[model samples]
Target: MASYSGNIDYLAPNGVKMLKGIDNDNPERVYICTPLDVNEIKLERHPQDPNRMVAKMRVNICPLSENYKNVVRRSAQERGNANVSVPTHEMQMSFSVGYIKSVAQKFPKLVEQVKEANKERDPEIMGQDPTDENTHLFKAIRQRMNKRLAMLYQPQPPQQPSPYATPNVGVAGAATGYVAPAEGTDPLAGFTDADVGDLPF
Candidate 1:
């Protein structure tokens, strides 16, 4: 039986800290243990600090042979698996941190270089002459602003009244003043107790 192990630091809400330990007897069935419940998981930034955040997750364990067989069957059903063979243990474990430390260490430097190149490609503009009151671009922008102001001041037009503003005569014709009933009017009006009749036996 092969064995694997690793550790991961995960942030949690309400200033809670979570640390996970991964352990597996077979490469495909890794077990991840943490303090968080599998349900009610949430991902959010710390209330006091925006830069830090919590990421919720769930873990699963599966047999290596079963996992591989399922993958092959899925591919065959979906895209026609071409009878490709699975990788050896050594090849499968090549992604382990012990095997890829040097590559990982250079990631930060590569990110910094990329950021510097991006900055150079989109350099920021500074005011020309440092001491001059105004530059050519500034004067042109000011003149365009004045022309826009003059055009805005010259506008003159009145809008017509809407057709819907008039009251609907057809609907208004249906309504009439309510009339009070005369003194001897039947208290029950058109209804009779016979409508309710006798209860069924």
Candidate 2:
């Protein structure tokens, strides 16, 4: 099993909220959302016990809702902005050896990616014992994990811009299907019952 040496305890200073009424069977409701950014992992002295070290990382994410996405798109269009970003918040979380092992089991491809990144960053990591905390390879693996997480969670925007604008496809064609939103109406007015999901980083 893959593992790290640092002690870690799960901590969410400003944790994501659990979906209110979905998945009643789950005591801990876990939802899927999009992560905007994940800061590089670092070892910090434990806040409660300075003598011990723990892994820490910052995650910025927004809850997933079809209506929320639509609102973002609509707002961007109103401002004539091409690039759009979802409303996001930052949260702090910790990683432990158990987390690494679980990731290695369920997400082996991630481990493989880390190995490749480690080799590119420091070829010596390929030969060093990964289990040893004193070795650079250990730190390299942690950094690689950060890289993989960022790639996996970052949101991907639309390739084409049709949804933002009704292209000039002749006057008759444009008028055929375009119905502009009200000047001062709630973008999410009709999506009050939309299912909101939490992004697990």
Candidate 3:
């Protein structure tokens, strides 16, 4: 007397149907199972569409008894083929933006520690004195702050009169026709290059 534990079902063109509770009166269409020695499982892709695909899976079914050996061998020969093995590796670390942000939030002391360490290493920033060894650092900080304030409260430059302000256009023409005395003439206007003669050469 043989014992079987696993269940089986029929996969048809219409749909899947259970075979366990069905009548076993027909010997020709009855489902049976013998102990099988499974070596490995194989998977393959469908022929039509590589992307929209199907798998061709196989499992080696070794026989426990001589009678079942032929059955298993026949099934194995019908289903089994050369299968490609897949390689997998263990995940070592998972670095994420959220994790980084969380770390920053959770360990602010660490951030402060790093900042303090950097300050210690740098020659130009000790406590808070402009004339100290860290004069350059203090100067840089002051300059940066000044730049920010200047950007915030910057004065607008004076706007120039538009070219179309006076519509009457003429070649070498002025808004007031008469040329006014050249305002504030240079005192050294009459001096020539030879006026300061006395070459050291």
Which candidate has the top score in TM-score? 2
Q: lDDT by residue for model 2 over 1-201, one digit each (tens)? A: 322122122222223232322344543444432121222244567889998777446543323466856887799989999776553322223344544444344443444455676677777766665555577765555444432222112345435744534222211111122233455543223322222222122
What's the TM-score of each model vs. the native?
0.16, 0.28, 0.15
Question: Quick one: best lDDT, which candidate?
Answer: 2
Candidate number with the higher lDDT (2 or 3)? 2
Q: How far off is residue 122 in model 3, in Å?
A: 5.6
Better of 2 and 3 by TM-score: 2
Report the poorest 10 consecutive residues by lDDT, candidate 3.
145-154
lDDT of 1: 0.30
Q: Report the error of model 1 at residue 174, Å.
A: 41
| lDDT accuracy of residue 11 in candidate 2 | 29
Indicate the residue-level lDDT of 151 in model 3: 9
- Report the C-alpha displacement of residue 163, candidate 3, in angstroms: 91
**What is candidate 3's local distance difference test score?**
0.30
**Could you give candidate 3's per-residue lDDT for residues 1-201 as a string of tens digits?**
432222122121111122332233442333322111110111234567665433222212222454544554566666773231111111111222332333334343433343354475664454444323235443333222111101011133445855633222222212232222354543223333342222100
